[model samples]
Structures are given as C-alpha cells and as structure tokens.
Target: MQPTEQPTKTESLKVAVVGTGYVGMGTAVMLASLGHQVVGIDIDQNKIEMLRRGELPIYEPGLEDLLRASQERLRWTGDYASAIPDADVIFICVGTPPLPSGQPNLRYVAEAAQSVARNLNGKLQVVVNKSTVPVGTGDWVSRILEDHALDYSAGRYVVVSNPEFLREGTALHDSLYPDRIVLGSSSPEGIERLRQLYQPLLEQTFTPPEGMPRPANYTLPELVTTSLSSAEMIKYAANAFLALKISFANEIAGLCECVDADIEQVTHGIGCDQRIGHRFLSAGAGWGGSCFGKDTAALINTGSEYGYTMPILRAAVEVNQRQRHLVISKLQRHLHRLQGKRVAVLGMAFKPNTDDLRDAPAHDCIARLMDLGAKVTVHDPVAMPHARREWAHLTYDEAPTAEAALRGADAVILMTEWDEYRALDWDQAVRTMRRRLIIDTRNVLQQLPQHSTVEQVGRTTLHNVPGNEVLAEALA
Candidate 1:
C-alpha cells in the first residue's frame, strides 16, 4: 500500500467509474487512494489507453500524482464488459451535457447505465449516480436497467444518488475532504453498502497526500443520507444557490461602483455576518465551468416542468450573462471603439489550475471582441492547447507567455485567476504594451506600476468610475 493509501476497516471494494472525464477520473483515482480496487471504463479507446500509460487526458491539480501513487490498485479499459462484471460498486459519472433547451441530455447517462446493466452479474451491486443529474434520475436509471436486461430479476442492484461536489482544479482535495457526502436510496442494503464504501472518507481515516494536510480544524465529513429525489435536488440546489450568490455579489457590485464604494469592502463587511459567510461572494467576469451555468439552467428548467418559475434564479442567470460584458465595457472606456485595436486577454480556462474551457467567460469575451472586429490575442498558462484545438472558430493569435500576450497590446483583460498571472511584474507589462489599460475581471492583482492603468469590475476606480446614470445606461 502507498503512503497515501492507508488501511481501512471497510473492505476494499471492486469499484468501477464509467467515463474518464473530469469527475469520473477524479473519483476513480480517489477511490484507489482509499484502498479500493478500481477499474475506470470509458468509450474512448484513446482516453483509456492514455490512462493505462499513466497519462491524463485532462488537467487537474494533484491528480497526476495521486494517479501514480494509486495506479497499482487502479485499472483502465474501454470495454465495459471487461470492466463492469466484477465491480462491487459502479459509479455513473458520465456527462449529462446541456441540451439546446437547457435541459440535460441524459442520453449518455442512459447509455452508460444500459452498458453496465448488460454486464451486471448475480452479485449484489451498488450503482452510484456521481454525475450531476436531474431529480428522479436514480429511478430513471433503475428503469433503464430493467429495460436492458431480460433477466433483470437475477441481478440485484441498488441505484444510489451520490452527486459529486468537486471543483475542477481542486477536485482531489474536495473529494477526499468533502464538505459532505450525500447518499440517497430506498434500499437499506444499498445505502449501507455505500456508507461502508465511503467509510474511509467519512471517518477521515486516510492519510493526506504530501503538502496537502487536513485543515487544522477540519471536522468529520457530514453524511446526508436521504431519499433519492432529495439527494438529486440537493446537487441542483447547491449549485444554483452558489451561482445566485455570485450573481448577487455582481449585482451589488454594480451598485457599489456607482456609489463610489468598494465591493471587496462591502462583501467583506457583509461576510462577517455568520449568516452570510463569504465564499462565492466574488464579483468577476461572471462564472463558467462544468457546473454553475448548466446546473442553474437545469434547475430553472426543472421548475418550469413543474409549472413553477424561479424568478430569482432566472435573474441570477441573466446577471451572470451580462457580467461578462462588463469587461468589454471597461475596454470601450479605454479605447473608444474595439475595431482595429489589439487586445490581450489573459486566462482562458474557466477558473485556474485546470484546462477545462467549458463555458469559460474568456470565450464569450473573446467571441464578442471578434464580433466587434478587434484583433485579439490570448494566453492561458495551461488551457491554450484546448483553446487552439477546440476553438478553431476563434481565430486569434495566442502568446506562449503572459508577457508575450501583453507585448504591444492596446488593452489587457484578466479573465482567469492563475497565481502566475497574479505574480506578473506590472512594471514589465507597462514597459511592454503600447497602451497599458488593464481590466482586472477577477480582482486578483494588488500592486502595479503607476504607468499602468488598472480597472477592476467590482470596484470604482478613477479611470472607470460609473455614476448612477452610467450604471443605468450599462443596464440598457
């Protein structure tokens, strides 16, 4: 056993995580680190091959190391038949991508369940839904399984709703030291089996990886065991609420700028109140990731399905979409028109430390700049390759380094909050660019040379101050 893998009272489970995407790969490695024998199955042969060679298809912090440390207990294969038959616990972590109507396309989820069902043996199995899915999906998976199997009566399986609450960059940390673990199933046997499977994490018995210590005052991970539907709803509710808080903070930020108040100071003041503990209270170029946007839209769609309208969540979604334009507006204030001007956009990955560009705000900002006829160049420390391959429609020059992106640029927009970007020499930026206008969407940087002009989204600066009328005009 590796130093990271400790002895557990719970028997080492034969675990299978379907889909080698961010969530599935993270969960698979995490299970291995907890002393579970894991097989990660995916339809993509290339991805499976990559995993077998100890390579990652995607970027995540501390994941490669964890995968290396735990690969002895982990297996990878493209064939579900080979992977699923012997699995004690199966985690369905496939993508539930958003449809054109904003409802999740559960085709992948259904397909994954069907594939696993055909291979289900007589051994009692726990099928866990680790994908962020709509409510009632557990029952839906059960029905699918029944439909797939002619001998459904032979295989006894329990569908457990256990939504993952992991952030992209910090997935390893979040999975091991989760704020809580939610398991929902009507079957006592299934729930008990899952409870035992997650015993190491729940009891915090596993040793932390090097340089990643348990928080000084970390408490035991709360386990919320409830009905399947409630467990599903909790995932949507949690994401929608976090999205709402970020939107709320951005909404308040607009008011703060017009009134000459700092959003940082205001949020800090409000955050002190225990009722509003500050976490997602950051006002930035809105939010983009695998979660917030899709989850919020799914929640709103769910409401509409039940003949209910969530006005607050709808408003939150609206505000978040508009928040990205604030960067363009700040740019306009500096350079009268975007046409023929060269703009440098820093940070392309949704947030940082991960190469996931799913709905990244930088995408929208750059697309809009392209529409406005601006000659745009971009740079992200890690995500540039994905941006280049996946976003060929976005025909913009990319820089190898942050300084190269800023060289001779008319204006700069800081989208993602990478530490390397935060540590950039502002004086060097001033020396490089033709015009040193910076719009700090994330409010990450602190010090800058006087020659460089900086404007943050949520605060009032002399260069980009907005009066009540300007704020109203912005709304227009």
Candidate 2:
C-alpha cells in the first residue's frame, strides 16, 4: 500500500460500522458528520430503514439533527459482506450482553468478527472492536481471521480494541468530543492509521475543544495509545471504579442510618476530597444501566477465570443488589403489606436520558413488588415502550408527565433519576396521591415538603430514627 497524504476536510474515507445500536450508530453519525463516508450495517432491516430515512432507531439526544445534516455521507444497509469489502475500517459495535450466570455472552461479537473474517478480500482493512469485550479479545479476533480464511496475508488485517465509553443519552456528544480516544493495536501501522482517522479530533481542527460545554465531551490533551489488553482493561477498570464509588456511597448511607447521621451530609463532606472525586458518589436506588453492573460483573468473572477473586467488586455487586431491596424494605415498613397496594414507580429506565432498560434496577424492584402483591404502575420519560414490552403483565401510563402516574397511588418510589422526576412538583404530587407516602429511593428529594410524608434510606429527622436502625427495627 502506498503512503497517502493526511486526510483533508474535503476528503472522505469509506468506513463501515457493523451493528447499528447505540455505540455503532453514534460512531457512524459522528464519523459521517466529520466528512467520513460511513455505511452502517445491521441485521435489523427495520432499524436500517429507519436510519436510511434519517430517523434514529434509539433515543439519543442531538443524534437525529446530525444524522439529517450528514445525509450524503452516512448510509445504512443490512449487507455486511458488501460493506466490509469497500471499507477502509470496519468497526464491530455489536452487543456483548451478560448471560444468566454472570458471564459475558460474546456470541454476537464473535459472529460479527467471523463475518468480517469470511469476507477478507486481501485488502488492507483495520478491524476495530468498538464493543466492550473481555481482555485478549483482539488476539482472538486476529486468530479467528487467520483460522477461517482460505488466503490471508500477514498484514492484511490489523485488530484494534477501541472500546467506547459513551453514555447513552449523550452518545453523540461523547463521540465528537471524547474525554480520551484510546487506540489499542500492536502494529505500528495500525496505530498510525487510527491516529490519521482521528487526527481531526487530536488536533482540535474540526471541533474546537476550548470552552466547550457539552456535558458528554470532556476535552483532553491528546489521544492515549496502549497495548490491546490495557485499552480493554481501561474500559472495564473505569466502569468498575465508578460502580465501586456508587456502591461505596450506598454502604456509607447504610452506616449513616445506623448512627443518625444523614448520608447526604456525609457524602458532601467526603466528596470534597480531591482523590476521591464526587462523580458517582450520589447514593441512590443503586447503579444500573448498560455499563456498570455488567462490566463489573465481567471483571469479577474475568478475575475468577484467572483463579483470582475480586472480593471488593463482589461486594459492590452484592451491595447493588441489596440496595434495590432496601427500597422495598422502606415501603414495607410504611405500608405494612404490599399486597394489592396501588404503588406507583416514577421511572423505569435504569438511569435517565436513554431508553436502555438492560439490567435496570426498576425491573428487579417491580418484579419483587409484584411477587409481593403490589399493583405497580410504571412510567419513564422515553422507556415506557421498552418497559411495556419487557414487563407485559404490568400496567404502563403515557400521561403528559410524571404526575399522571403518581395520581391515586398508595406510595410512589423514585426508581430512575430522570431530570424531570428530580424537579417534580412534590407538593402537587403529594396532594394528588391517595396516600402521602413517598420513598425517595434515589435520595433525589433532598428537601421534603412539610405536608408530604417523605422517607429516604440515609437521611435523619429530628424524630431521631436512623435509616438503618429503622430497617433493623422493622426486621427485628
């Protein structure tokens, strides 16, 4: 291959992004917006058609506008073979959802890699693993390509692990202005090609990083390069530490309940520490969403595979699971029996912004409450459709807002921390509800109205009842 001049703004390269889910679509849209000709390939025909029509399959903020703007640059298709052959880089962004046994199901990723392997036309293509996979997966992909092909050259394909650290709702912003672009490849040429591809970002040419207030994009000095394993570990380690912080806060909240100390005050005092940053320190219903739980679990499982035990991570997972029950325990104390109680759940999606319900704590809470005989009415900003489909037996409400779900409820539980739910008219909701009982599971309601009965897991009142003591008292 001849050395080509550095890509200019007008120049466009053919890029194929396999898997049109959150990560894949966000990448395709961002690359296309940056003047790269991107073809998004997915098995879902409906999703491809939606993308082709400039309609995003997922609910990502600011994505549709970008997709609309990049009309000529971005295209969608279900054909993977054709897309792979005509691409400079093919990114595998398929899902690696965890199995029931807490192991990552990499079937989708392996299948995608195999498909790329089968269509190797001896052209120099950089196969990047955009999906979050286990360590040594890059090596596995390289071997898969070498094993499957009838005729394969030594440097025909270079495997790189460019794990994505995108938050669901603000994925587009995260893509355009990422905290750090990590490129992992053993080959020097592979690294240079990726660097060239992301040169615009590194130079801050296309999008200026100075004084950018995009919530998702935190500007950095330069891209970070490392070995394939280190890059993969960076993703898992970052997520694990964040999950640990959340679980740590929850554990501290439990202790605050024991000694009549308010968890909010405790977190504030400790969060000011520079080393122990205050990013994920908010004590809540528990951490959920696509990343934390699964990644942490995968890390633990990875540790076990190597005959090492991750006790702290195991405890984090346990605490997370227990935090959901903590909400239930609070409700059981106030209402005595959940059977036949008209309970309203404020949010269904794990966190807010995106409609992703994978491993959402609300599901576990709703299922447990239903088993205990509570008639649950759930509502979310954008996840109602997904929730309804997942939990068919439960009733769903699509009112103008959260107040509709809170109306005529025995008690309301704030499951997901949506911004709308945070700024809700508590007084109006208290008055409209059949009962004034409110369990602030996410610790969102820092200040409670005088009229309404508000109970949080880690806060204390002048009445002197500690949160944990109250739980212990109830259990005793």
Q: Largest lDDT belongs to which candidate?
A: 1
Over 1-476, each residue of candidate 2 has an lDDT whose tens digit, in order, gives 21123544644678999998889988998888777889998999999888878898788778888789889998888887778888888899999999877777989988898888887778788999999999999999899889875577889789988988888876766776677899998888788878778766665556422333333334443578999999999999999998999999999998988898888778888889998877888888898888898899899989989999999999999999999889899888889998889888888887778888888888888888878988877778898877667767754444556788778889888888788988887777777788878887877775454345677867753222235445444222
Q: Number of clashing residue pairs in every model?
A: 0, 0
lDDT of each: 0.88, 0.81
* Regions of model 2 farther than 4 Å from truth: 1-11, 207-221, 393-400, 461-476
Put down candidate 1 lDDT per residue, 1-476, tens digits, no spaces: 11234555768989999998999999999999989999999989999889999999999988998899998999998888898888899999999889999999999999999999899886788899999999989999999888885467623888999999998888888998888999998988888889889898888888888767887667888889999999999999999999999999999999988997888888989999999989999999998998999999999999999999999999999999899888899889879888999999999999999999999999999999999999999999899988888888986998989999989899989999999998988777667888878889998866555555678867765332334354333323
